[model samples]
Target chain A: MSSPAEYAPTARTVPTRSRERAAYDAETVHAILDDGYLCHLGFVADGLPVVLPTLYARVGGTLYLHGSTGSRPLRTASDGGLPVCVTATRVDGLVLARSGMHHSINYRSVVAHGTAHRVHDPEERRLALDALVDAVVPGRSADCRPADAKESAQTAVLRLDLAEVSAKVRTGGVNDEPEDADLPHWAGVVPVTTSVGEPVPDPGLAPGTPLPDYLRRFVGA
Target chain B: MSSPAEYAPTARTVPTRSRERAAYDAETVHAILDDGYLCHLGFVADGLPVVLPTLYARVGGTLYLHGSTGSRPLRTASDGGLPVCVTATRVDGLVLARSGMHHSINYRSVVAHGTAHRVHDPEERRLALDALVDAVVPGRSADCRPADAKESAQTAVLRLDLAEVSAKVRTGGVNDEPEDADLPHWAGVVPVTTSVGEPVPDPGLAPGTPLPDYLRRFVGA
Candidate 1:
């Protein structure tokens, strides 16, 4: 995984702080993206920076994001390739250091800089839509009906190439000063985990409709 | 809570899609922000939009984000007021609809557009840093040693007013079409939750060092 051929971080994706935590490997970047269900999408709207939370899925070296046709960001990108920044983060633990200034989070995050273009091809859009659904719960697309023509026409999918991507990860315990370490303060890491609770069946679910096997073992990132 | 004095969403902060989910009350906005300890901060650098995940705490009508003094985004803001967008999202559940196009996540998110400026006042910085630590685990700051002069000097705290903030929330079960409801596909909501596991003590902890009471009751968003 340390092979240099995996990923090449551009200047934009490189971290200006804690460079030791920055990773430029495809494996690391993909793992971080795959582990998370949501991403903060940043784009310039009317020359003002706008960040929106959206669902995303990573398929190989490309990331797919879906929204309604009326979504401002999607509509803006549909006109042409819109320069966008997408970031996915998974907080693994809360680092409680001996000092307030030293408090931090143990997290794995990936920042991607790319141009997002709306997927116009019907076949590709369908595949992207499926990927998005399956990204939430593995094998979910298989258990559900695919979008019909009218539903497909109303949705907008955007694709971003994973060209400029880097993952920054912080792990391990708190880093307290040597002097502060002897203080009576309690310092350690509180592990944070995102997990799926019991599935709530729809009120209108048909009798004897069983919960899908994929959902029973579903674990969020 | 619906009073007009609470929040006034501008054209930029208004939702262009799913307008029903958009919320313009201060209580809603603050609640969403308070529940999450992390936020995706968006700012433009050299004409390119950048989004980074960082720890944040909401104090009154202002949100404080702290980072290394050497961080690019913080340095960029310290020069002058930098237009920034901060977004926090919590995925409550995965809404699996009968059709792929209707798939969505039940989430609560707040998108705030404001200008962030570095906090230079020492007293304010201390208060903000304390709020940040306590934000992760309630009453954590009291149990931890305060930041020393040198540590505070090296850190950069940016304050963004929560004036132009709005929360968008999506809840409830799958909204499948009546026609597709009869499809054999299974549809429901898988609840997602972020929880705190048992605290991991530091390897170098001194003998008789007890786990703090705050961590025992810690509950993540």
Candidate 2:
């Protein structure tokens, strides 16, 4: 399989701490972003920092965020491109070190800095919304009905080009110092994973509506 | 059990979209925050929005963020209080709808807007660091070695008061339209849960050091 191209790090995308954990490869960045279903969208609101959790989908080199037409961030972006920072993180494990100072979490995260603009084109908005659905469940877009004209008009899709992005990852066992190796404290990694539980059918679902194959085999980050 | 006090809504914390999902009760906000181990910390840097995922712990009305003394954000906060927005989110399920527009995720999220100041008091810093370790695994602090003077000196802790906070939650099945109920599409909620897997021992762990009970019964968000 062909790998994604690497992204060159700009001054802004370069992390200041733990430079070894920072990855500029597109493959690494996309993998972390794709595996995550939610992103924290950051923007300046009234000159104050504001971060909001929202559903997101990645298509090609762009990230699409779902929001209501009346959402403040979407409206602000529609007026003019809104400078935004989007972050997605997955905690893989808890690193229990011998000392409190060395304790950390094993995680994979991507941070993207760019301007988000509202997607207004009818066809593009439709495709973006469909990608979002499929992002959550592969092949879900094809199984579901397409949005009608009014529904499309009511939803707001913000697109942010993945021009400045970087991924940070921490893995492996605890990093306790050799001096404390024999401290009798258990030092290791407790793996953490997101699992998909049984699907709960809607109360009004038609009888005998079997669970789809896609969801039956679904796995989350 | 005593319930957590509610925080009054300010114009900033009020969500423009999904007003019904916004919760002002401190219990809801604290529960969401406590259940999450990672948070996306947002701030403005050089007139651009930046969001970074980091480890954090909540103690009563304060959220303590783990950082290094050399970290940029910590250094900036040490100079003066840094305006920050911290957000924690836990995805509960994927809501599949008959139409793409109605697809959403069931999640619990909290957003706190405040200033984070560098924690300077040594005693409080030690307690905060211990709380952080215990936050990951209950009773972990007592099981592990405490940080030495030099280690504590090198670690930076930032504290943000849990003021101007609000929790937003979306639960239940997909809210598909009545007209699309019989569309022959799969519509339901696929529950998502974070599970703690088998603990992995460090390769150099001392022989006969048994896994701690706290880790054996760990349950992550």
Best by lDDT: 2
The alpha-carbon lDDT assigned to residue A16 of candidate 2 equals 69
Candidate 2 residue lDDT tens string, B42-113: 988877788888778889889999888887788889988989999999999999888888888899989989
Error of 1 at B5 (Å): 5.1
Chain B TM-score for the candidates in order? 0.95, 0.95
lDDT of 1 by residue, B56-102 (tens): 99888889997889888888888888899999999899898888878
Q: Note the DockQ of each predicted structure.
A: 0.81, 0.82
lDDT of 2 by residue, A1-221 (tens): 12359877988878767899999998899999999768999999878888988889998888999989888889999988999999999999988888777888899999989899999988888889888888888889999889888888898999998888899999888888888888888888888889888888887887787777777767422
RMSD (Å) per prediction: 2.7, 2.6
TM-score of chain B of 1: 0.95
Model 1 misplacement above 4 A: A1-5, A219-221, B1-5, B219-221
Q: lDDT per prediction?
A: 0.85, 0.86
Listed in order, each prediction's TM-score against the native is 0.95, 0.95
lDDT of 1 by residue, A67-88 (tens): 8898888888888788999999
